[model samples]
Target: MIGGFFDRYCGDWSPDEQALFEALLEEQDVDIMAWAIGTQPVPERFAGDMMIKLQRLDYLPIDR
Candidate 1:
């Protein structure tokens, strides 16, 4: 999937990564939730904005 410093939690990085996300969000140019859970494919059963952010960071989960 994504090539980066991903860990186990990377799969479920939604609002969970608050600290890191907040910092990134402050950057403004970066995605707030560059990682997320429950999001896959184009249209997500979860939410689009979160998915979009994750996809942008290539941090969303792959269908296992």
Candidate 2:
């Protein structure tokens, strides 16, 4: 799910965004779900802006 979005839209994001998305992909599913649901903290590095971007996916206008 997230990986598909990354592949579709990551080219428009900065290098750091791309890296952060890849890092998220490498994580365990439970941790990812926790972050997605706000039950666990997202890493401080990708905290504010990046987290917002990822969480906004459902609301975004995805072309693919």
Candidate 3:
């Protein structure tokens, strides 16, 4: 489900956001949940803006 959202919106994402999307796909659900909720440290490569993009997903406009 998350992967679907990423693919759907990612055409407009920055390169770093794209990278983080792929990285998230490679992770387990628990880890992804922790990262999304700020309970664990996001990997250095996926920190900062990448995490910010994901955390702000609720604000993303959906066509449907």
Candidate 4:
């Protein structure tokens, strides 16, 4: 999931966004997945445009 997100958006991200993503990488995978799936509340620091985009889950290839 993270890899797909990076592939789809990393190239277009600004340096700040890239840094934000890198910081996000330091978080637990389960936490990240929860945020992406909306199963848990996103912490204030991680709640913003990037998280919003992740929640969309459009980069994932699974049929819906």
Give the clash total for candidate 4: 0
Off-target runs (Cα >4 Å) in candidate 3 are 4-8, 14-16, 59-64
The clash tally of candidate 1 reads: 0
lDDT computed for candidate 2: 0.72
lDDT of each: 0.42, 0.72, 0.73, 0.94
The estimated TM-scores of all candidates read: 0.24, 0.65, 0.64, 0.92
* Collision pairs in model 4: none
Best-first order by TM-score: 4, 2, 3, 1
lDDT of 4 at 33: 98
Worst 10 residues of 4 by lDDT: 55-64
Checking candidate 3 for backbone clashes, the offending pairs are: none
Q: Where does model 1 exceed 4 Å of error?
A: 1-16, 30-53, 56-64
Clash-forming residue pairs, model 1? none
Model 3 TM-score is 0.64
- Cα lDDT tens digits, model 1, 1-64, are 3224244335666665545544444542322223333332332332444445555545545676
Writing each residue's lDDT as its tens digit, candidate 4 over 6-47 gives: 999998999999999999999999999999999999999899
Residue 56, model 3: lDDT of: 61
Q: Global lDDT for candidate 1? A: 0.42
